[model samples]
Target: MAKKKFPLAHVYRLLEPGPVVLVTTAHAGRTNIMAMSWHMMIDFEPPIVGCVVSDRSHTFGILRKTKECVINIPTVDMVKKVVGIGSTSGRSVDKFKRFALTPGAASYVKAPLIEECYANLECTLIDTRGAARYNLFILKVHKAWVRPLGKIVRTIHHCGRGRFRVDGSMITVPSTIK
Candidate 1:
């Protein structure tokens, strides 16, 4: 197959990382949920994560004030709700109430963990140096939870604009290789 150079605008679509997550934030009794796809793991032990939350987003303000959030890993079954929540601003609507998401108590953060997601990570905003320049936040995941049966909790990864890919197969690499 012949290859042609693509435009820079389409560059992000090529390196789409990990699954889309619903970030939940709370501050001064105001809680909001925003669907995000720009999160990545930065560490192994202690589990540090990096995520981008634009200044224009309402969740960003709450996150800055509270310095806490819950990273909710939704499954393929919740794709519709993920896209639906991403299309609107959480400031205008009570996303939890409007979307019928059950918010569960977290062990380390004030932000509530989303009960519907396959996995939930309680995060504390550890650094904000990149937030002003790149809309990125450095978080430390203090607590984590995953659904019991892996068979039922299949997650979705973002490919590009409005397109998502769900987990299809499983492969386990031998630890002895290391």
Candidate 2:
């Protein structure tokens, strides 16, 4: 096999670890949403998620004040809206209305769930040690909902430079770890 060397700059998105998600947050009577790709599950038993929200981002302040949010997993069909959400600052726009998304009241959090997404995880910010320096928020997912299975839904994964790859094909294998 022939190996080619490449710049280290583009390695971050070689394959994003998880699906792109829309984070919905509410603070002081204001609700906002933003597209987030830098997130991962840090724990399985209690469903802990770690994500980055830039300190300069509008959502950052809102999330900081509220200390809660909803992680909405959009389907591949909603890629356009996802990009649009990320393109504009929520500070100047009401994403739910601008993106034509419904705000469904969440049962566990003050943040509303994005109705169009296939899955929504109601999260509460549980840690802030790395927030000031890294803009990293550690969230505890207390409640989650997923669209019915067997619906042929796909998730979009960012591949850097405005390019994305849709999840395709399903495979199952026997495992005893569970």
Candidate 3:
């Protein structure tokens, strides 16, 4: 039997239910935003979230120290900005200034919410073990804000690499037992 080798782009495309996430962090009065696709909801009772931030990312350092962050969910219109933020480092330049984005203070976290995003989730670090081991952080969502129009707007979904897909029509599933 022969094993086939594939690139990460190809492998990531197979991951279903992908959502583009914008991670916000603040330190020393400086706030930054970084795009991420490696995020997901973990629990409902306490509203937990999981996100992967590389050890070298500037946001990682801020998050580690502040123990708080905001997860902003953007619409398809922000795909370009999302990719741009992910490609650059916050230490070099201010992403909000460079990208002309507005920052709004979060209700529960020090990290500011991105004004252009469709939704924002304020989170506080629940554990640092995963962050130290796998560059993963588990956060407990404290509060969330959603744009009035965001409910009707489509969101960008990452398919890995530079290819991103937009959210399509929604369908409500009925319970079989009901």
Query: Which one wins by TM-score: 1 or 2?
Result: 2
- How close is each model in CA RMSD to the real structure? 1.6, 1.3, 2.9
Candidate 1 deviant stretches above 4 angstroms: 151-153, 175-178
Return the TM-score for each candidate structure: 0.94, 0.95, 0.90
Q: What TM value does model 1 have?
A: 0.94
Q: Number of the top candidate by lDDT?
A: 2
Between prediction 2 and prediction 3, the one with superior TM-score is 2
lDDT of 1 by residue, 1-178 (tens): 9999998987877887788999999887878899999888898878999999989999888889899999999988889999988988877988888888899999888899999998999999999999999999999999999988655457788877788878777878878762
**Residue 130 C-alpha lDDT in model 3:** 85
The residue pairs in collision within model 1 are none
Can you list the residue pairs that collide in candidate 3? none
Candidates 1 and 3 compared: the better one by TM-score is: 1
The local distance difference test score of each candidate is 0.88, 0.92, 0.87
Q: After superposition, how far is residue 29 of candidate 3 from its true place, in Å?
A: 1.4
Error of model 2, residue 151, in angstroms: 6.2
